[model samples]
Structure formats: C-alpha cells, structure tokens
Target: MNFRELHQDGCFLLPNAWDVGSARVLEAAGFPALATTSAGIAFSLGRADHDYGGGRVDRDTMIQRIGEIVAGVGVPVSADLEDGYADVAATISMAVEAGVAGGNIEDFTGDRARPLYDLSEATDRMVAAKEAAGGSPFFLVGRTDVLLVGGTLDEAVRRANAYLAAGADCAFVPGAADAATIGTLVRELDGPLNVVMGLTGGDLSLDDLRKLGVRRVTVGGSIARALYRHLVDAARELAEHGTFTYADDQIPQSDLNALFDPKTH
Candidate 1:
C-alpha cells in the first residue's frame, strides 16, 4: 500500500532507516513503509543529529542519502527533513525529487532560546510543505516539538490541529509516551496522529499504541543507536579482551548476500 493509505486507518509500525543497507533490511522484514531518521543519518556520517546552527548533515547530503535509500528498497520511504534546513518549501521540493513517498518537517528550532517555531510560523511551514508536494500523494507529516521542548500538551494539540488545517496529512507529536497522553492526542488532534516510540526507552508495544488509536508509530533513531551501541561494545571487547563473542548473534554472511542480491529483490 502507499504511505498515505497506511495512515487512513488502523495502526502500523514505520521503522526509520539510515542507509541503503538498513532500508533493505527493513523492507525484507515486511514493513510496508519506511522513514529516514535524520539523527541516524547524521550519526552514521560522524556528525551530531540536528546540531546547533545547521551542523547536522547538509541538505544536499541528506537528499543524496534519501535518494540512495529509496533506490535500494521496494517499499515507500519517508524523509526526516530536519526543520526543513531553513527553507521549508525548497527542502521538501528536494525530498520530492529524491523520490520519497513522504517526509516530515519538524518545528524544533535548534536555538535553545526559541526551541520551537511559533505556532503561526509552523503552520505556515506546513502549508508551504504541502504546497511543495503539488497535490501529489506524498504524505506530509507535521511534527511539533512542543512537548519535546517542555511545552504543554494543550499547546501541542493546538499547534497540531493548526497544521492539519493547513494541509498536513498527519500530526506527529513525539514526546508523548504514556497511554493516557497518547490517547488524549488521538482524541484531540484534528487528524491522524503519529507517535515516535523507543526514542524515550519505553515498553509501549505496537499493540499498546494501536489500543491508544495512534495511526502511526515510528522508532525514530532508536534502532540506529542500538546498532551503533552494539558496534561500540564489540570494538571494546576486541580491543580490551580480545574476544569475538559479539559475533555469535550476527546474521550469517550468506543470508545478507542472498537478501541483497538484485535478482532476489
């Protein structure tokens, strides 16, 4: 199914991929759609996620990576366009050219003084992003960092609804983890709500999120972080203890080779 159709009703898990290999693995795992995690991409490139004053991976690099991931997978992929990199519409246009099925434009400004865009400005950005899609099927997810930046839930609800009114297909409020809070957002938002799980170290399963009426659940950069942590641990073991026990649970080389074969895909 197309990415927008997945959000029409019911709930689905949208795993975030940082590169072509991860995107292919997620497609092989049976996820209908995938989303790129800016944090994951930045970290993989030896940079910080959404670093202060645009230090995170530049727009050209991000678009190139997104294109590579989309080309490597059969499933639809959404992009994590961090705050649109100062040009909300142009950034989205670039994402569309990259062939993403959809992409998110977040409201989290890097400045600590103004951690989030004003509601009016954020709604305008969503409108601009929606227009950049040119009425295509590309899903525009409006992400508000209200709660993530210590704002109130009511403020988040308001900003999300405004974005929806401005043509966002989904409202993503990432900081709410509990059932009650999620349920509240679901009940209050004007349109479908997208939540990010695993980012805050929670036990909220897909079933749990489904019960709360969350239309979409994404893991954000949790998977990437876990993989990097594993690599760090393995390197430490090899360096300090000269042990290779970390290879025990690794995927067999043959399996990866088969999975990545062009003919197999």
Candidate 2:
C-alpha cells in the first residue's frame, strides 16, 4: 500500500521505537505503524548525533537499520531521514532507495535552529527527492521547522502548503503543533497532515488529532528520552543514595520477554 493511502485511513500513530526491543513492544501493543526516531537511534549508537546533522551514516547502515525495523514488526516504518542526509542529488537518490515506506526531510542544520536552505532551495530539494524515488509513491514528507525556530504557525502553514505544492506527499510541522494550528493547516493545505506528538506531551489524543485533521502522528524521541531519563536517574540515585524508585515503575519483565519472543515475529 502507498503512503498516501496509509495516511488517509484516519488518525494513525507512529510511535517512535528506538531499537528492536522497543519496536517489538510497540508492535505487540498494536500500533498500526512505527517510524524510527533519528534521535533515538543516535543515542542507541552512543553517537553524538541529531538526525543527520551530527554525522551522516553510510547508505548501508541506514538501509540495514531501517530494514531491520521493518522486519522486526509486521508494519510500515517511515524513517526520520534528515534532509536525505546529503546535499547532492546523487546522495539523495540513494536515500530514496532505502526501503522505508516513507520519510521526512526537514531543513534543519546541526547547530542552527533555523532552516539551512532558502525557501526556494528547500522546495527544489523535495522535488528532487520525489523524482529520485522513481514513482514508487512513497510518502515524501516535507517538514517545516518554523515553530522550532521561533517562527509562527502562520509561517509554518505557509511553508507546509508550499512544500505540498512542491511535491511532498505530506507536510509535517514539527515542534509546537497545537490543535488550532493543526486544524488551520488542514483547512489551508490540501494534502496529508503529519504532526509530531509528545513534545511536553501530546496535547490531544489520537482521536482529537484526527478531529483537527491530522492523519499521521509521531512521538519523535520522547520514548527514547523517557527511557534515558529513567536510566540516568536510577543510576544516580543508586550511586548517591541507594534506591530504585525508577525501577519500581518499570514495565514487567514478563511483558518485555513476551513482546520479544521469537514466535511473535
């Protein structure tokens, strides 16, 4: 099935799963699809990475990792492909062949909080990515960082619509996506809506997001960060005070084992 169709089926949450274990748990919990969070993967690798900004991975690495997630769960995976991780058309061409059901290409730089390209250049990049994909009809999501870079929702909506016009199958406005803003974008733009869930927290439930016209919702790195925070706090508490408060609130061991059972796959 094509990504547009996957997006059109009402509100679907693509909970970000860091590794095989997390992916398996999400699959067992019955998520319709799971997308990889770049932040989560970076942390797993012990690499100082932020999506594609910190360091670019070889095509083999991306393919192997993405394919692993796709194989681990019987569901679609939309990779968090940061700007296709390259500036050249040839590099982006290779990225489109990575076997993800879809991906989001955000115009973010490593240290800068703003888009790396001018509006026109960003549009051209998205167009190039679409052509490189060879009409397999994958979701070429164009993400606007207006909110992230201290810009307005109206600006984000405009950028999103422009991205849609430039051939993105869906437009994603990460950071500070509110119901009113999301609803406004839905009414203003005429394609699929992809919003990031769980910044501080998802202000709306999946059903609520759908009502605001969001088709796809992703939780970004919150899952990985939450897990990290627990681990760090637990370690600190034990190192200093001898306690396991974080461990007490953890998921049961049986559930974890059950989710990763070989037979499940």
lDDT of each: 0.90, 0.76
Question: What would the per-residue lDDT of candidate 1 be over residues 1-265, giving only the tens digit for each residue?
Answer: 6777888889999999999999999998999999999999998998888745566688899999999999999899989997998788899889998899998888998888889888888888998999989967789989998998899999999999998999988999989999889999999999999999887798888999998899998999999999999999999999999999999999999999998888976
Can you give the lDDT of residue 164 in candidate 1?
91
TM-score per candidate, chains pooled: 0.97, 0.88
| Best-performing candidate as measured by TM-score | 1
> Which portions of model 1 show Cα errors greater than 4 Å?
52-54
- C-alpha lDDT of candidate 1 relative to the true structure: 0.90
lDDT of 2 at 45: 77
Measured with C-alpha atoms, the lDDT of residue 167 in candidate 2 is 82
Candidate 1 TM-score, C-alpha based: 0.97
**After best superposition, candidate 1 residue 96: deviation in angstroms?**
1.0
Worst 10 residues of 1 by lDDT: 49-58
Residue by residue across 1-265, what tens digits does model 2's lDDT show?
Answer: 5455777667788898877788888887887778898778878877645534546555457656776787787877788776665653554455456556777777665556455567888888888877777767567788888788788888887788888898888888887567777788888876888888777885588888878878788999899998888788888999999877767777798977877888868
Clashes of each: 0, 0
> Which pairs of residues collide in model 1?
none
